[model samples]
Target: MQITVIGAGAWGTALAIAASRQPHAHRVVLHARDAAQAQAMQQMRRNERYLPGIDLPAALTITSGPLDALLPSARAEDLFIIATPMAGLRSTLQALQGVPASVAWLCKGFEAGTGLMPHEVQAQVAPQLHAGALNGPSFAQEVARTQPTALVAASPHASVREALVQAFHGSALRVYANDDIVGVEVGGAVKNVLAIATGLCDGLDLGLNARAALITRGLAEMTRLGVALGAKAETFMGLSGLGDLVLTATGDLSRNRQVGLLLAKGLSLEQAVTSLGHVAEGVYSARTVHQRASQLGVDMPITEAVVALLDGRLKAFDAVQVLMGRGPRGEAV
Candidate 1:
């Protein structure tokens, strides 16, 4: 299998390494925006920016012009994983000529305008192609290093899903197959926003009690909206949903959580984002997700608080207070 991964950020680069690690004859091609970075990866056998210490596989190739070079010649079962940010998804889909027979999205976050998941965008933009998503409690650094990790590759077709499981599964990576692509993609994307809330709580030194409350309350919101969108409830309890929610909320490797840390350090949201110098999906996702959840009448206090905090309408502590102040009711919404 020849796997082409678009984008060369932390997660994208890591997925490339994971694909290269597959036992079958494989060529893992990565598209990086920076030609210099691509050239360096070609020479150095490592992604200097994202996975610095981890060694890239020999079969891995990095290219700056993947849209022109890789997308034009995509063949059947030649998996193309778009790991780019959500903002560019539509345009990239538009420009690409040869849509691979099987496409996997490592990208998360809703489409800015349409508020669609990666697979939803794929269906909308390229209806004829087979599409799915790769997601879980995955941190790019750990994946690049071949750390024992569990992830989900979800497609509507069980056969297509299994092929990806077989293509990428190895001793270091534990892959699960599912038909709930919506649950997995939505879980992976929305968790980042919820993670920011927990991250803020932790960074503020708000106590373990506060953090626990936030995570528990956040999961309710996540699951509620996911179910509202037609995702099975059990999917939320699996790796892609609750598993990812817990991990990203507490994991130090999360960019969204790190942003919260910076925010707690007295820097404003804008200042914190500027310092990170990378795309944090949570920031762009917060407003749209909260808006959509509201339209659906789904309970998402954590998301609402995150949005409130970002809009300067709520303080970090006050966000928690706001959640706490929600009228007394039963545990489940």
Candidate 2:
């Protein structure tokens, strides 16, 4: 099968490498946005800037050509993985409007201005296309190294899910099929925001009890917003939900967690963001998450607090206090 992965960021590169490493000889192409970067990766056989220390497999083709260059390869039997961030999903889908292939994205956040999830954006931009999302707890670096990882291939359409499974699922990587795209996308997106909160909790030297409590409640917030958005409540307990939240909140390699750690250390938001040199989806999508929750009349206290903190209206220490100061209420999911 021919596979084209658009957007050559760390996650995109990792997935391209993984696909190329599959036991079967499937043709795979990794597309970078910049022509120079594409040439560099092709020549050096490594994605040094984003995925340093990982060798690109000989079987993976690297390209920085125009979007039209991908059209010829977009057959019904092939898959186009939009590996761009949430912000680029719309334009990428727009570019692939007429392609006859299953499309999936690696991004896990709402669009910044429109506050749309990846599938929502796809619906608006290219509703005729068969699309879905591949998401779970796995990190780009870990997956690039061929570490064991399990992910959910979520789509209302069975073909998109099956294409994802056929193209990538293998001995070291497991892909589960899920029909709940809304639930999976919600879990994938909200976990980043919750990870920021967890990072702040840990950065403040809060004990294990605090961390556990915050994570449990954070999962509640996620589930609330997800169910309000038409997702299955039980999906929150699955890989894309509980598994992803725990991994992002606690993983040392999480960019969103690193943002909170830097902020807790007295670095300004700008300073922390600039230091990371990559998009931390939590910082960009916290407000949107809060907005969506408010629009849905869902109580997302943690998301509201995160929005406040990200907006510079509240300090990190005060943010914690605000969360703890909320009126005591009965525990509910």
Candidate 3:
């Protein structure tokens, strides 16, 4: 099997490495946008910048080239994983327009202006392609290190889900197939925004009781927005929804959570982002998530708080105040 992974960021490189380790001697190609980055990874046998300390598998082919060079060679049975951030998803899908491969993306956020999920962006830019998404609570560094990780292969198409399972399911990585693309995408995207709120809650030295309450309530917000967009309510209980929210909200390796932590420590938004050196999806998608929720008549108070905090309209303390001050309501999904 031939599997090509585009985007050489930490998540991209980690997935490429995981696929290369699959039993079938799968031909895995990891693409870097910059020729110099590709050369460096090739020569060093490591993605030093994004995935440090983990050696790239010798069987994995690292390439730097135009989309024409890569897409034209992809056959119908091959799989393409677009590992770029949400902002790059449109262009990446456009580049793969006529490719015969079953496609999936690793990004987890709405497009900034369109407020569309990854699958939505794919539908708009390359509706002709068979595409899905790979998402869950797993972190890239752990996956790259060959640790046990489980992820969802979400697509309305059965073949796409099977292709993903065949390519990535292994001892170190467990891939579960699901037909709920909308639910999976919504769960993955909204969790990032909620993670920021959780981080802020933790950074404020709030009690564990507060943290637990935030995660539970955050899941309600995610499920509401997801269902409003036509997703299955049950999907929120699965890996992409509740599982991902728990991990991203509490895990130290989470970049979105880090953004909130930095803010709580008194750093300005610019300083917090610049310090991370990586894209925190929450910082970019908070506003869009809030907008989409409002459009759907879904009340996402936590998302609104995150948007306010990110926009500098409210300080960390003030954001908490806003959330705590909301009128008491029945706990409902």
Candidate 4:
């Protein structure tokens, strides 16, 4: 029951806390990529950059690399959760090239260079490892706060899914198992882009009418792209897809929404991101996912608009106008 969670971001720190609650009291290690960050988390008992003031469990150890936690001779990992961001997943995996099996990823974004989902990227880099993805509407803050949350643990391998359910599920956290890894991964990643569109609506001071329209239509596009990428339509309606979309778009804690609001109020993308003091996955994913959607012939107007606004090619208001003016079609289209 030894668990190693790689990454020191808000979500990663939250996972460390969650692991500390395991009944058997697993050896939970949080790997901070930055050595200074690791030392700070160990001393302050908080990820001061993101989730501050939350005390960490004494059993939750922080380290800088795989050598510190997953070394073959050292304390081995019975369960390793790769919670690192999408940008560093490949490099992180590469660093653990000799890592043992039973590794899972908590990342929920598509890779930038190849436009691949986290699982796809994982398979490409290390094809032999058993991998699963944990995804849903759950937020890091809520998870850290022990707010009740539900998420799906999905993998093509049945054993991996069941093991994940056993390791993470408990009273405050619920885990559902499924074989549709692509569906869950796609749903989780695309919701971030849709959240950006919702943020723009909020920033513009638009009424509920506009926000409602954007959310509904954004779901449609997300499903379209997800299905085009080999995911199930029903999966988009499940926790990873619809659940995440609604929570992130409407929740006050969403950085994606904050970014959109900032841009709507005349702040540059750089300024907005700087003010947030944390990376908003949607801001970067919107551009990458949008490009992949276009090449796949999936209709993603909302994603397109967000990309335009981020690229400075179109204003937020203009993007809305474009959405409204697009050729009228049936609701299903």
Candidate 5:
């Protein structure tokens, strides 16, 4: 199988390396938008800016060029993975229009202004394409190092799911198939926002008991919003839902978690984001998540607090107080 990953961020490069190292020797290409970055990776055999310590497999092809020129040779059996950020998904899909390859995205957030999920953007830009999402708890650095990780391949189309499994499932990577694209996407997007809340809880010197309670309640918020948006309630208990939420909310490598930690330390939001040098999706998506949930009549108190925290409307302590001050209700999810 021929797999083309159309971005050279940490996650994109990592997956390309994994696919290239497969025993069957599938052809893998990692495309970068910057010509210099592509040239540097090709010559050095490493993605220095992204996966600094990991070496790219000799079998992996690194390339850069116009999207149109590069994709003309794409065949129906080929697979294209868009590894760009959520903001880039629409333009990338527009460029991939009419391509025969099965497509998937690695971005895990809603588009800022439009508030559209990745699948929704794809539907508007390239509905004819066979597409899905590959998401889970795995971090890019760990995946590039060949650590054990599991992800879900979610799509309404069977061919998209099968294509992702064939391209990525391997010794260190387990890919599970699910047809719940709505659930999978809701899980992926909302978890980042929840992770910010968890980070704040930890940074405030809250006990593990608080951490555990926050995560459990956060999962309930995610499930309620997802179900309102046409997703299965049970999907929240699965990898893309609970698994990804726990990992991002607790893992030190999580950028969203880092944002909350920084905020708890009294750093301005700009300072925190600048210090990390990476996109913390939760910071950007929290308000949108809150908006969607409110529109759907779903109660997402944690998400609301996160949005307030991110927007400077509430201090970290005050946000916690607001959540803790909610009116009593029967325990349910």
Candidate 6:
């Protein structure tokens, strides 16, 4: 199988290394938009700007050029994984129009301004393409080191799921197929917003009991919005939902969590974001998530609180106060 990963960020480089190291010797190409970065990775055999300590597998091919030139030779059997951030997904999918290949995206967030999920964006720009999301609790650095990780290969199309499994499932990686793309994508997008809230909870020196309460309620909020958006409720209990929420909210390497921690330390949003040196999806997508939930009449208090905190409308402590001050309601999700 030919696995072409577009975008040479940490996750893309990590997945490319993993695919190249497979015993099946699949052809894996990691494409960087910047020709200079591609040349550096080709010559140095490492993505120093992203996955620094890991060495790129010799079999992995690094390329960069216009999408028009790079994608013309793509075959029907090939898989194209878009590893760009949510902001770049639409443009990338637009470029992939007419390509007879299965596509999957690794980004996990709602699109800003449009408030659309990746699949929704694809439907608008590349509806003919067979696409899905490859999402789970795995981090880019851990995956790059070949750590054991299980991910959901979610698409309405069986062929997309099968191709993702064939290309990625082996050794330290486990790929599970799911036909509920809506459920999978909702879980992916909402978790980032909830993670920011969880980080704030932890940053304020809240007890483990508080953390547990926040995560549980956050899961309920995620399920409510997802179900309102045409996703199955049970899907939130799966890897892409509860699993991803737990990992991103508590994991030390989570950039969204880091943003919350930095904010709690009294840094301005600008300072915290500038210090991270990486795009934290929650910071960018919190407003969109809140907006979509409002439009759908879904109660997403945690996400709403996150949006307020990110927008400077509330302080970290004030956000917690607001959440705690809410009137009692039924426990239904």
The CA lDDT of each predicted structure is 0.83, 0.92, 0.93, 0.83, 0.92, 0.91
Quote model 6's TM-score: 0.99
Q: What is candidate 1's CA lDDT for residue 21? A: 80
**Cα lDDT, model 1, residue 65:** 61
Off-target runs (Cα >4 Å) in candidate 3 are: none
Model 2 has a clash total of 0
List RMSD in Å for every model shown.
1.6, 0.8, 0.7, 1.7, 0.8, 0.8
Flag the better candidate by lDDT, 1 or 4: 4
Model 1 TM-score is 0.95
Candidate 2 residue lDDT tens string, 1-333:
789999999999999999999998789999999999999999999999999999999999998878997797567988999999888888999999899999999999989888898889988989999999999999999999989999999999999999999998998899999999999999999999999988888898987898899899999999999999999999999999999999999998999999888888888899999999999999998988998898899999888988888889999999999999989899988
Candidate 4 per-residue lDDT, tens place, 164-244, comes to 787779888999987889889888888888888898898888889999998889889988887888888898888988899
Query: Which residue segments of model 2 deviate by more than 4 Å?
Result: none
The residue-level lDDT of candidate 5 at 196 comes to 91
lDDT of 5 by residue, 1-333 (tens): 689999999999999988887787579999999999999999999998987879999899999988887788999999999999888999999999899999999999888988889999999999999999999998999999989999999999999999999988999999999999999999999999999999999999988999999999999999999999999998889999999999999999999999989999999999999999988888888888888888889999999989888888999999999999999998798
Please list the residue runs of candidate 5 whose C-alpha ends up more than 4 Å from where it truly belongs after superposition. none
Clashes of each: 0, 0, 0, 0, 0, 0
- Weakest ten-residue segment in model 6 by summed lDDT: 67-76
TM-score of 3: 0.99
Q: What would the per-residue lDDT of candidate 1 be over residues 201-305, giving only the tens digit for each residue?
A: 998898999888888877778888888988998898899988999999999988899888877776799998998888899999888888778889887878888
Report the candidate with higher TM-score, 1 versus 5.
5
- TM-scores, all models, native as reference: 0.95, 0.99, 0.99, 0.95, 0.99, 0.99
lDDT of 6 by residue, 1-333 (tens): 689999999999988888888889579989999999999999999999999979999899999998887688888889999999999999999999889999999998888889999999999999999999999988999999989999999999999999999999998999999998888988888888888888888999988998999999999999998889899999999999999999999998999999888888899999999998999998998899899999989888899888889889999999999999999998888
User: Candidate 6 lDDT (Cα, whole model)?
Assistant: 0.91
Winner on TM-score (4 vs 5): 5
